[model samples]
Target: MTSLNEIPARTESVELEPLREDKKKIFEDILRYFETNQRGYIKVPTGWGKTFLSKHIMKKYYDEGKLMLFLVSKNNPLLSQAYYNRKKNQPLFPNSALLYSERRVDRKELAATLRALGQKKGEGFVLFASLQTILGKQSAEIKDLILKFTDLAIVDEIHNFINNRGNDFLNEFGERTKILGMTATPFQGVVGNVKFVDEIAGDMREIYTKTLPECILDNELAPLKYTIAESSEDIFEIFDFEKGLGELDRQDLFLDCSTPDRLKKVIRRTQLAKDVYDSMVKQRHAKTLVFCAPVRKRVYGVGGGDKEINAFHAKLTSSIFNGDISAKKLEKDIEPVLPVDFKNYTPEGKFRDAVFISSELPKDEQNAILAAFREMGKPPYVLCTVGMLIEGFDFPGLETLILLRPTLSMRLFEQQVGRVTRLSPISGKQQGSIFEISDSIDSLYQRFGEGVFSGEKVDQVQMLQPEIRLEELFSEGDAARAIEEGKIEIKKVELGLRGKGKGVKIKEVPVKLPPTSIRAKYFSRLLALTEEKDVGAFEREKRELMRAALKFRVRELRDAEELAKLAANVNKLKREAYEDRRLGDVSRQHKPKVFGEVEWLLKLQALNSLKYEGEHLSLQEKNRILKTLGFEPDFRKIDSHRLKCLKLGSAHKTIPELVKVLGFVSRLSSSETYQFLDKKKKEQWKRELLPAVYWGFCFIEDSPELKDLFESTEWDRRVKNIIRQK
Candidate 1:
């Protein structure tokens, strides 16, 4: 065990400019806020260099001789990102350490080193630990040691730290400690409720739309498209608060899906999705990603079971270890599973083996699988877990994503999509494709609707678009021409002679012409001619065409420039403006109003209307009363007064008085009437009043009435209710 006393006092700093102007401003604001207050929250989207910023901040404090603790989620990818950032950009932290599940170190030695670095007896040094390790008590001693020296703490994936299990750590740190919580998804429920020492930094939509989305759409980065599948049954029922939530909390129910039978169901569904992917690949020859749930196998008698059974299992394991398995099985079982239709799959000599990657595999095995998959000829596909692929894994040849799992959280869904969206460095192409097979449309909608709702944003849900028959795109003659052209490139490579040795000139025998370039041109022409009459349609076609062309191009272009240009063109089409333009002007004009309407609807109050006449109100009379109260009245615009009245219901207010007011409810429930009057007398809490306040900067400049209402106590109660609802 490493002791704190042995650790050296080595810390260094690096100068870094923010990746973008907005980022720079946001970074400065965050730093300034922290400088004044000692703690703050910064919300920036993934790929926006949050890790870089964290490192920069760490370096700043390290240079000042303050002990800073950088905390991250237990996720391996995130840990890897931190490690890479430190190693490459901030290399001066000789005392820095990584705490994760796989890494083991001597605690005594570490502690001694920390002590030597002035960490003991109220001294401190920087330490890195995953939230899980911290929470699990694995790093209890280290955590305590750091606590002595800790002046500041940086929390990554802050949202995860707010959950019930994580709250303990937060509470432990408490008000005394200055803490910074960082997350891309800042609004887990209500934005205001999220804890921050002083200030919240950056706008989520602005950063995503202006920075990340632009990079993706411009093919400066990898582009992503989503495909939503409508569900036949309401999947929400399975996640209902009363029943499903409790079940999810229980280990048995949560892990039940990992059972062999349940896994079979998943496998069957995955195979069906894989079949669709296969047809697409055959038609276009594209690389693809196959995401699956975690694999947990119970080797019944492997390690410490019955002696006879253990011996047999041990023998089998040893056989696997010694390479007794044939190359075919080694390729099949050891290598990552590639997306191929085994039912009628015939490899074209190039793809001899498929790759299978899983988190369950040992690190050596995982590396070997990746190497084998990469070594396979063009149009290689790999089967990987959602867990492993969501973070650090980058394969440029990945042009297609086969979504085998459905997720609702936009952050997770987007991250998974991002795996394929990264421009394949190998091919230098900008865009990728996705093939999603789901039983439910709502699931698809939830996963893909965010960007679509933003009129200025391109709909990324094109990955799920159904495949169209390619026969109509070209005649047999055209197909033949493409095939011939593709073969020509192969012939050129094969016919070129080379000297194998001195005085031995090898006559290069003509190699069989491969259908690569011809296929790419055919796919490109097919894409160009593909009719897209709507934004949704255009996005779908654009992604598919890009996938096909890039898959072919990856084989031809060894140069980066050509690949980048191809990628850029594909990315441009994925943009909302570009897709909308392709769909014609009507879409562009309607987008803003549609978003505005949705926003308005979210703020509307639920009410029943009634009409009254004299002492007794007939059904018809009650209907008239309801109609007069603006319950169902047709309103052309959503203005301040109307919005207020919608939020604050009326209760048996005089119709004439209501009509006199610019916006008033003629009738409301008795309860509402009392509540409204009560609300009028209270002091407002500005942060709690407007429902749109949760939208942060969007409603910051709300009308005076809204601003005043928000400052009242009544607004606080309403905000609490909204938080509870979330």
Candidate 2:
């Protein structure tokens, strides 16, 4: 087993050339495009220095005595870098002034700079501001002042501007002031009904284009390599809504649908922690970036008096460290900038090679942390973050990217993977390595298509799946049966049975248990049995194994019975309350009606009808139904109908038509045709029916009444016929 404590010593690094020669040729081509077009944006891969190229254009306009306005989005690192560069008196853009909310320059001085630029006296001065600041209602005066003085505006990462605010900012400028927008992926996603690429194409022309594969071929970026680490444990075994319904009801699982997403997140974090630690052990000298799952804080507003805890972040960080240390000392060492409500819990670790950063820290403090991480000989070589380091941050020597966060957004995945593609030949870094720690890669490829790599082959690394231990398998309720059935593999064992004075029998047996300390304990017990001499003692020893096997079966049966009884109680409650009303109305001279635990479905149907009719049920009707469903009536800001369905374990089937189909299943479970099938076949039929109905209901909704058609003997055939016709 690979352990966290077995990290190897750091290897020495080698030095190489500062910059690749091909950048000069690429730069010359881009310069020619800009000179001919006068005003247009160029598409360059990340780490190809779009900032450097944009600055080149800015300097040209500066030399010609034209003032420029440079805009970036919020949370962008370029804003901080520009601020730092100006403070350090760097040559990049020394004559720049900031107009963001955190500006340190006096308004009088800003006004003076704008006045000088407007009068053509401040020849080289430029203005930098975030889009939020320029579009703010409070900054209307300054916004007007800058627009009047600026001759041209440069927008970085313009794909981020596919929003109402971005459109509003662009609308303020005209052809008198040239608008140049730069981005790597303008066609990232759709804004409302239009693609972002199409929406921006009308306003900006593509001056030059460079794809990721082209960049690699031209030696502009390092070649890419990636790996997908698969977790041995399956998440489905931990959760089964139907089989665990009774246990789930006791815990009120359906009341909050977020439970499933939360469980997946925690499990994903744990798996990533192991693989990330293993990767660090393999590459002790590499500069690595780890993207962790978002920090999830659970706020206890009632009993704890409004307290918050960073549950997953703390767990993941401690798992990565995996060291022996006092919880208090560990907590104090890796303290977060913001206060947490960890009344009884603190993470334990003493690992100092990694540093965690988030937006909770002040901007200046975040900058200082990044500066320390950039030091080659520093103690902290790995930087862990949730989302603070994905965009616009340039670290050419970063050689590895460990992705612990799974994303469905193509734009987000691209930005994250781009972090390590920068060339760092000076630090002996040749190829970039990406470690994808989850199963989200397939969906991402399907969504974005294979052209994401631009024909660049991404080599796969085969990671060994973690081992399975006997204790772990035995402790798991579902997998315990595999051990008793001799399905698991254990090392061979030999035992000697003594029959007479000098005669002895030896037998070799293949034990069916996973390799673990528990296997050794079992083998020791078996050896004790083989040494028994007396008949009674030998029988007693043999019965011990049988007793242990029976214990597991008994526990499994008991759990099933408990779950069955709990489900019965829930159904009885729903049926009883509804039947009482039905019987009461019958005694009062009304016709009796057939009923079951179907009021929730009826309520859903009534709501759907009312919504379709452009109306709502009376308050009395709503409260009456809600009260019978065991929820308080007229609760503030709560969706009563949806909550009722969730509590009843039918949250996903919310549409009236689907609810009606489930109610039909409840009715059919008691019908003659359904009762005629054998137990095993009946279970298989039900499992097939539900998912089939869920996926095919739209095609067969108008074919016939579900109850009437499904109640027949040939109901399965009718279902297929109806679906095939559509």
Candidate 3:
């Protein structure tokens, strides 16, 4: 083992940006926060020089004889790889002990470097390692050397590690050191579950946040523009017999992207992009990164959605690696591709191989792909990937992002676009363009409308949309002419821009395409499906909201097929929204509310209704009682309050909630009244309280008052009591 004295440090070079204010501000802010704070976070978008910011902070502390531990999650080795590359290219970045994919020499250097940093008090050192490696399988000595030597830990991708594994590290770090957690999308971890950023970062005190637009204004990040294509729903619905094909979730996306029909669609679009960019933007094959969604199948057999559509898929996965048996079994349906993690299914319903097309590349292979893509003379000039390159993979030469897959998450959509948004020197990349193939995401379209084309001003930092320009790939007139003339059309759009800050915002703008131009008239087959909506905009939007709510309810119950089928047709959805009471037909007992809102009144009425027989109460009389309690009685709630047994309305709940509540209510004796009393014997927040005071799974959360009344002394043994009640 190398000892502390064996490590050598190169003379730390001068700062990468000695005079850049944007760079200086980050280091200074971190330093200021570190002075008094023990743990905090800094939020920075990707490609906004996070490495540069990290370098200045690390260098500042190292020079002052303070040791820093920069922990990056292994899942995102791109950060580690990125930092290492920076150290090689930028002279000012410090020599840190990087513990990711290490060669023998690299390991020796790390050990010796750590040993050296441990011994020297005045000499500064920064240790870089993944959370899993340091704490996952390391020996005690290695762990001790890391913990004891570090004064402050600057964690990149802070949200990534805010889980149980992250807690394991934080538990060890404790009060002995300070922590500066950094992430581009802050407060983005588990929404329902406990959040790590909230717990560790604590309101991001002493933090500086700048938007993509602001960064562009400072020339710290590249400017972006967007173009759109029609949704893939039409083709997939018509051709794909597979269930739940258009959902845009992982499995749906994977199945759509890898299939022959869909793959051909994506490949064609990519080629078109290359041809268009070459003719329009530059005289080159548009260097592109095509983000392909994976092809997926159930591990065991047919999936949940499969059963809904009566699809009993054949066994295709098992015995594949063994090779002969799986190949023979799936020979009819699947053709052999590279025996990588890709699978093929045939027209005859047979699967060819156990391979999966969209399965993630192993780290070694992923790193290799990244390395090759970085090479200027590589053949895969058009690199295709799924989820890996969304962030951290920095290829400035990448001029275009072809979003072949759809994403709903705004953060995800932004990160995918950011991949091409790097200003490149070697490839002479000036700006990154995003080709959105579908309107599957609202935030994406909204960003284009509000932030880009409409030029609507926004004040909030969160709303400081990146200065993106969106153009109609095919104008209405162009589409009409293309249809009439039987010609191809390529859609091009541009927006004029002006600089407001740092003289960088208006440095360059994409030129608008002129009418009567001789450019290729490229059109997607998807155009045929883009008929204007029959309903007016406001009515259509209202109907969609109602339709979405019902779909959400169906989804909560795991009714994938119903939701998928309902989502497929607009007219059908509109009819359902108008006709179904659970949707927006509010005249019915179960009135429409927000998607997740509980049908409290309707639910309680369905559970149990006991007639207050001793008092001769009218519907109006009982309605008074419910009104006194601040609940406006629907006629059902009032009438149900008068019944002795539970009403049948309880069956109306979505299946899961209905089943769970039924089971819970059945066990509760009719004699036990729910109580929420302030008395010492029965304090507030007791479990008996009919209105739920505690939060839990949405199903068993009952109404303020339950139903069912038992008049018999022994309910099961009461014939006389039953006769009297009747």
Candidate 4:
């Protein structure tokens, strides 16, 4: 077994070269960060092609004749995976060799191997080893080799190296060569004032920013539907090994705790997975992976001797390969103990599916099994393991994940969920499903709650929300026009009266003002009308207000001129009231300005009403409108019902008249015009129409006038869909 303390020393210096397009981008970014800051971290999410990027970095320095050392975990699976990934994709490092205790070639022999490869016209050499082998008996040779040849050190899973007092690897390695530590999780516990590189840090990296829910909605991964199994007691009770073995002596409890109970649970949860796999096999068969926990428990007999019990243990000691039995044959006897259901169950073999139960297998055997499985052209439908399938396993065909383990760590949860999110080669869709069976709903909620868990923050700014809202705001013709003409002014103003007091002598009175800006140009224009004497001028204002009330509005909605106009209007109106000759019947004398103000306010009110009506249409109603207009209800062509209604004039009170005008202007057929009239009667005509209205405005690509009508929105999905049809 490999111990954590004994890390091997890196010996060979490999010169690497850039190999792939994506790798080149990563290499440039890493080099740029290194040059400017001296140290930085690169966190490419698993399956984002980290190996290609690493090879590219190696090649860049190798071409410069600089020596580089690649440090990886001592596990055979990880080491072998890295070696093969480099060999197949990156041929520049032909001199790369594996370093493990079992294959411990002496220094002189290794030097010869290096020299042989060095003579092959390569830029550099790479020495691979387990960390235990490096720090143990091979320490002296490895240290000397590193001091002699190493220029740059690349440490994988660098997060594991922190906080160890005796481990001088980081300090010593940093003293000589540039140290780059790479890990999916970079932060350990809080250590004040320790400078380190981090690609993802703080609350920004949480699930809120990159949530599982959002991933499922976008079809980046399959959505998870959970089922809870009721338990009499906590599952942790079964794992309490500290209690005396005698406590489990009860026959009834023992029988209940047998393989049947556990198997039943597994069967219920995995039934869906099996069904999905079988369906895929029947149609277009594809590879799948399944993971299960180890089933090994120590049972103490009445005689006080402990015996290991496993589902496969009985099969290891008995075999009937031959009819004859001999004393010498007993030594090599082994039984074939398949799972209890294996005898009754038969795989159709339509989809090539195999099972690899990895509980007590030796490390080498486990690695060999995984390697063999990976090499298969049509591998197993399900690759099962305990913890092995959670990380470092990348398969693009993996489109479904079944989670039997319940975890509170969002990091671990996401990592496990990510196993099957790789894009499918056949469908070209990055999709997968996660099925979790657990009784702990609270645990699930807590794990995915409103804070950071497993190194990912849950408060990330929502990308879709902002983009969608922007698209909606700018999709309207008037809104877009105001934005393009720079007519919209979002600013704040203070309201105060400098000249008079009601029914009293004038006195110096100071007042504080509210801090808010006017956002709409029409509102600003209305405010300007307050400065004019004739209230009729305000009524004749051509601009329209999109929002309902100036009060209780967002600061972004107000403009400076609008604020000034409001203050001037109120002040002037008040003065006119006091200056009027009629005192007793003042209402009758100043009724004109009041009515004028009300008229302007009503126009603003009407515009707001139109906006509200536009938003109320349903998808079916919008679709009906499109169909009536002799256009197919193609979502990609026009996704918004609001925009459709606005185009058809079905959103406003005078929609019939408006539709007639549109028909005459466009010379639309009578049938098309009649269809537009019929569209208004559809249910949910308002709810779905708002988005359509916004999108339609955004889709008028060539018409600058129409384009100017939509300023705050972008030509995004909703608009693009409409534009595509146009």
Encode model 1's per-residue lDDT on 1-726: one tens digit a residue.
333443444533444554566556755666676655644566543554566767766766766666667787656656655654443554235557666666665665765655555534333346776767765555677666665556678887666664455555655553335677776544332211233221132111122222344444333455443332222333332122234222222211111122233323333344444334433344343555566433233322222332222112112212222223322333334222222112111245442223445445578866665655554254234444435556445565666666544443344554555566455557654456665554432343343333222221111222121211111111112232333333111111111113453321212222221233333333333333332234432333332332232222111212212333333333343344443644556545433322232222222211110110012334454334324333443322323433453333221122233233311211221234425754443222221122133322122233444344333333233343332222
Candidate 2: 10-residue stretch with minimal lDDT: 456-465
lDDT of 3 by residue, 1-726 (tens): 323233346575535456377567667877787777777777666777676667677777777777777778754455455345454553233555555435222454455566777786787767666676676444345566777777888888777665467756765765658887777655331111223354443333537766555555456666555554443344332123253312322222333333434433433433333333333454244566666544444222223443221111111221222132332233353333323223333357443322222224466654554565566644334455555566566678777766655443344555676677567778776667665444222232332222211111111111211211111112112222322332222333322223453211111233332211111110011111112222222222222222112112110112222232322333343334345634222322222221112223222322222122213346665454344323455547543342211222222334334444433433332324323323643332121222221111122223322222222222121111111211
- On residues 1-726, what C-alpha lDDT tens digit does candidate 2 reach at each position? 222122221132211123335555654665575554534676766787777666666666766667788888874458656544453344245566666766544555566557756885536656777888777776666677776777778888887775567756765765556767777665443111123432442445676677665566556777665554543333222222233222111211111112434443344434444444453335675777777654323421212333333333433443354332222233443321212321111344322566666666667766776886776656356677766777787888888777665443345555776888798866668677776543322222233232222211110100011111122213322233333333222222122335555432333344332222322233233323322222222222222222121111112222223323322443454345344543344332211111111223323322322223212346555444335434465524124554453344332444444556645554455445676879986655544344334222322233355434433333343233222211
lDDT of 4 by residue, 1-726 (tens): 333222223234444453556445556767775663433455534455555566667666666655666666534555556655454454235545556667554655565444443344344666665566666654566655654556566666555454452135545543436555565544332111121223121111111012233333434333332212232223333222223222222111111122333423333333333433333333333444554433344332211234444422111111111112222333343331222322111355332245454446677765655665555355444555555666567666565554444332323443565576555555443335443333312222233332211111110111011111122222322332333333321111122234364311222221111122312322333334333333322222211111112221211212223433443454465566556555335343443444333333322322322233234446565444334333465424443433342443322323343333322322222233324645543222222332233223323342344444332222222222222211
TM-score per candidate, in order? 0.50, 0.49, 0.52, 0.44
Give the residue spans of candidate 3 off by over 4 A.
1-6, 9-15, 75-96, 104-120, 187-196, 201-206, 231-252, 256-281, 298-372, 375-379, 439-726
Which candidate should be chosen as best, given TM-score against the real structure?
3
Give candidate 1 misplaced runs (Cα > 4 Å): 1-22, 84-92, 115-125, 135-138, 174-177, 187-221, 228-272, 279-287, 293-354, 370-380, 386-388, 391-398, 408-411, 423-427, 440-726
Q: Measured by TM-score, how close is model 3 to the native structure?
A: 0.52
- What C-alpha lDDT values do all the predictions have? 0.40, 0.46, 0.42, 0.38
